[model samples]
Target: MVLYFLALVFGLHIVMVNLGIAFSTVIPILKRKGEKENNEIYLRTSKQLMNFYAATYGLAGVFGTAFTVFLLSFYPSFIGLAGHLTFIPFGIAILAIVVHFFAITAYWYSWDKWKSDTHFLIGMILLISVYLIPLGFRAISAFLNLPQGLELTPKPHLDVVAALLNPTFLPLYLKSVTAALAAGFFTISSAYMLKYGKGDKEAIKIVEKFMPLATIAFTIAIVLGIIYAETLNLFVNYKFENAFGFLIAAKAKYDFSWLFIIKLAMFALQTIAIVSYLKIRKAWRFSKYIVAAGPASLIAIFAGEMLNSFSQYPYFVAKLADKEFVSSIPQPIRDYLAERLNLELSNPLATSMGLYTLTLVFLVPLLISAVIFLYILLFGKERSEALD
Candidate 1:
């Protein structure tokens, strides 16, 4: 039950951040294109995306904090150890987020007040800052998967460079970039599709522009994801085997393979929906395919995230073999952790109370915010009344 809630919050955070990063990547380029070409439609699209990003940013921060709190609450020892070793990466992510927030504010508020070039510069700053966040966060994820730079002897120590540049990190980061692009473009396409359905002829142009980009990104994401899985296989073979069965003549044990298979199925469905939309975009009778494409892409992304985490189940940091995995963590530190760490639920009462409180505090607000964002994206006027 707790794991479900954790997954829920984490999924929400991932979606929010992914979409935000996607917008960050394209918004500046769109703005520049608009300026150079003097196209009102491109400028309007950029502004709309900026508004969408602003709408989701709050929800992203909330979900991220909730995820952190859940980790601290449910898995204190793991969180503590990870933080102690990878605090620099955490610091980097936090600083990047702060800078990103300020840059976005400056960009949004100074829209027409500032010169076009100056505004574009701020947008670029926003893009760089947003990208840095995942760079820092993914380092910890890479370390969790492979613990590449840690000297877990008398006390745990981290080699910041090695940890940041772990083999797993680059693949995962690239996958994220591709996924973000796919999600962002598809989302924008979907939103404009809604507008096009509402008889806004100009909106079809946006859909036409974004759909191809979305499809290309989605294809790249799938390839990058396969590469990422191969990278994981090098370190955590069991999890990989459970996921893909791609190891030397070994079949995937049906542990978490089913989840991955379902994710793939979702991916296939999204591809079909996208292809169908591309083929019959002018046919009103087949409009449902266009509508299905967005949710299909989102579900596939969520399923991939679910498969990634759940496949590594029954272990905080997955390993190949006990003896092999423990080689990096010296006996003293192992003994210390063994003595102090209680991996199981230590206080059910506290856990229950925490869950209840967080559901009320975080979950309610998240739902409300999501509804507001959807409304703004789908139906709100050009000038958002909520923002103005």
Candidate 2:
């Protein structure tokens, strides 16, 4: 249950953070197109995307903090050890986030106040900064799967350059960025589809414009995902082996392969839905399919992330030695920690029922309410105006 709660927080953080990434990725292009063509819809969408990113930024911070706290409380040893090994990447991500926030603020506030090109440059800065975030964090994630940069024995040490250049890092980063693009465009398409249902003819145009982009991005994500999985297979093949065995739950043991299939299915559905909507040109009859795209993309993203995490069960780091992947943590140390800390060495407060109850009752509701508030602000009849 505790691990599930932690996963929930991490998942929320991933969604919100990716939303920011997706918005940042598209906003500048939209702004530039709007400027070049003098299209009101494009400009309006760029502004609206900025607004959505701003709204989710706070929620992302909240979830990120909650995730960090959960890690600190429950997985102190893991945090302590992992933090030491991956501090460089973490620092890079943190720095990028700070710069990204500032760039977003400047881009949002100086919209018409600055020259068109000047303002677009600010948006570009925002885009670059935002993208750099995933670059650093994904390296850390890849490192966990293949701890290539660090020596585990004779006093642990990390080679920063080697860590950043891990085998799985590039594909994972590309997959995440492309997923962000798909999710962002699909989400925008869904929003416009809703307005189109409410008799806004203009909204359909917006949907038409974004749906194709979403499909393209999703296609790239799918390809990159395959590349990522093959890279992971180089380290861990068990995740791909017997991938569909979960369908026969009665006879099969649990495995993370089901997640991979579900993610692919969702992605396929989203792509087909987008293509069909583009071909049909009837937003009303296909409203369900159009709106479902957003949630489908999100589900696919979540499943992909969880598959990566769950596939490495029972160990935090997998170091390659003599052409085989094995736990980076030595067996003797694991045994000592288990014996001394009762098999919960990674989670010091594993038995803290009171703290768990407090978090579930208080912290969880607060986070949920914040999300509700954001939904109201973003989708309500009275939408928030751009800061400028």
Candidate 3:
């Protein structure tokens, strides 16, 4: 369950960041183009896109806050050391939500007011905030987990700001930003194909130009991520290898072989996707394959992150009496509980409510149906033609 939740959280985080960056970049680029007709069309489409982006960011922020609060509830001890840093990220998230709201409002009112530059400035400010807030939140989270931190329990050793300013942090931040940009590129490509397809020559041209940029961004992000991970010594002292080694303990059953395999597969798929995107003009029909590959690659990456997060479950709250918290509990007590109740003490991180578990499940589907019906009623056959 922890693995699943981590995977979901990681996937949503990547998607949200990508959407924010893609819309922010694409809107401005479209505006800057000298083609008046194309620009006008893009402006109208961008308003809708911006609304979607804002909703996505808002959802991500809400989920992030819930997840953080959940973590706080489970591991009350970490509150003293990590809670403040957690709130730091939450604060950024709030700022992002507020900025997005203002931006969307300004956009709605600016259609007739474009002559005044104030609306444009407001839009640009919102875009900047969208990019910066998420980046700041991610940076703060990464900083808090660095090795040079004050031990949460009793010892105060390292300076918080200094820890945040570490050499490794900046590289990681850059890598994260680039990854988000790459995700954004893929998203933009998908949107262009879905909306414009073969009919819109200008849109095709724009997408064609953007594809290479996305590819370049993704490549650089991967390279930088590798370097940053190495710099952090993520594999130092055999931390990964030992925990996931072939030589498992006597009672332990599953190894991390599946995780390694999944990671390798993800890497191979991303490589193929990149190659396919580069040759898109030659194999235009195969563009959908490349598009599909993008999301698949993200899923694979999410799986790998889940494995890493799960492996560190025992150490979720570090510097406690137990090097590994699960192992520290008395064996007989564990055994008796397991035997009598068929329950074993697992990682607290293993708490996730599946999508179907939500309370307004029926209402959600009903609402969606009603919205579709209303759209059909209002637009008649024109909606179908437009969609096609």
Cα lDDT tens digits, model 3, 110-154, are 744675366567767766776766555555545433434333343
Per-structure clash totals for the candidates: 0, 0, 0
List of clashing residue pairs for candidate 3: none
* Pairs clashing within candidate 2: none
Misplaced by over 4 Å in model 2 are 152-154, 238-254, 281-286, 318-344, 384-388
| C-alpha RMSD by candidate, in order | 3.2, 3.5, 7.2
Sorted on lDDT, best first, the list reads 1, 2, 3
**Model 1 — which ten-residue stretch has the worst lDDT?**
338-347
Order by TM-score, highest first: 1, 2, 3
What tens digits encode model 1's per-residue C-alpha lDDT throughout 1-388?
Answer: 6677778889888888888888898888998998899988988888878876776688788888888887776777667667688888899999999999998889888888999889999999998998899889888777766777877555678889888778888998889878888978887777777778877788777887788898899989989998998898877776677666542345554366667777777677768758776686575322555656676677767777777776655555555234566665666776555433333443355477666776668677777877786776556684455433
* Positional deviation of residue 196's Cα in model 1 after best superposition, in angstroms: 1.1
| Candidate achieving higher lDDT, 1 or 2 | 1
Candidate 3 regions exceeding 4 Å error are: 6-10, 34-45, 84-97, 108-116, 147-158, 195-202, 234-264, 282-286, 304-308, 317-388
